[model samples]
Target: MAALILDPLAALGRATLAACRTIGDVTLFALEAVSHLVRPPFYGRLFWRAFVEIAWFSLPVVALTAVFTGMVLALQSYTGFARFNAQSTIASVVVISLTRELGPVLAALMVAGRIGASFAAEIGTMRVTDQIDALTTLSTNPMKYLVAPRLLAAVIALPLLVLVADVLGVMGGWLIGTYKLGFVSAAYLKSTFDYLEADDVISGLVKAAVFGFVIALMGTWCGYRSKGGAQGVGGATTTAVVTSSILILALDYVLTEAFFAQ
Candidate 1:
């Protein structure tokens, strides 16, 4: 009986210890990446390539998601507010909802799904195929050459994506309001602008930056640490996406609380 009880306890302790070690390792890795960012060898071409991959290529999906979200949000807001005779508030609601919450969160989740998995697959494959070792042999720092560019691109791209998302979302609401709901185009746009504070937008952008960092960090860490071979690479890719997505949602709540704390 005592042996059984102690065995489970021991297993739990080991799992807990492993989790702590992983957290420590990830923290150190992130610090190292940041330190490398300030050092020489900026890798401009890689940075530009990553920028295009992350930002420009991501536009179509982001635009579609944002516009449709805005339209649906406008309809929902009108439905709820109509009961209270507050239909005019729909524009403000849609804009604020997009800027303050939906825009950054959804965009980050989408990017994490796209880029996070890609990073893991690419890097994990490198680890398996010995390409990373080759880089070190050639006097190239893999962290700078491979990781830094992607990290910087994600940080830069996510905020821009969120900004575009904000605009498209608001435009979606405007289109729906004017065409479907009989709202005056001029009045809806005016209300959206009037009630949407700079702080709301700024806070979302700030969240976007943090989310971008976390997404890249998770993806790189998973891929770099992958073991085995093809199976390991697949597992790393899936883990990267799942972990990045969960962190994005969890961090969104923490950021919202921080931004709105009374």
Candidate 2:
């Protein structure tokens, strides 16, 4: 009985230490990546590729998701307000909710699921195949060549993607409100514009940037540390998506609190 109890305790301690070590490694990697980003021998081609992949390639999915989300928001808002005979508030609700919360949150989650998983898988494959080691042997800093460009691309692209998402989402709301709900187009747009403050838009962009950082960091960390073989790569990809998504939601809450804590 004592041996069994001691064994479990030892396992717990080991797990705790391992967690600490992993966190330390990720922190170091992030610092190194940032340092390399500002150094010479920059990889312009790699940066452009990553930017296109993370931003342009993601446009269709983001636009589709945002449009449907706005349409649903309008429908739901109209239904809820109709109960109280306040249908005029539908435009304000749709715009505020989309701009302030849903647009950023959904876009982040979508990109995190898509881009984060891809990053982990690609990096994990490189690790498994010893490509990363080859780069190191060739005197190319893996942090600069592999990590920094992607991280920088994500940081820059996510906000732009969110801006597009916000516009498409509002347009979706406009369509639903005017056609499905029989609201006048002019009045719908006016209400949407009137109720949406500059702060709301700014807060969403801030959240997008934070989510972008988290997604890229988690992806790089998971991929850089992958071991074993194919199974390891697969596990890293799944972990990247799950962890990034959860972190995005958690950070969204923290940001929201900080932004609107008054």
Query: Please, what is the TM-score per model?
Result: 0.98, 0.95
Residues 128-151 of candidate 2 have per-residue lDDT tens digits of 999999999999988899899999
Clash pairs detected, candidate 1? none
Scored by CA lDDT, what does every candidate get?
Answer: 0.93, 0.92
Error of 2 at 152 (Å): 0.4
Best by lDDT: 1
Off by over 4 Å in 2: 1-9
Go through the candidates in order and give the C-alpha RMSD of each one to the true structure. 0.9, 1.4
The whole-model C-alpha lDDT of candidate 1 against the native structure comes to 0.93
Q: What is candidate 1's CA lDDT for residue 247?
A: 93
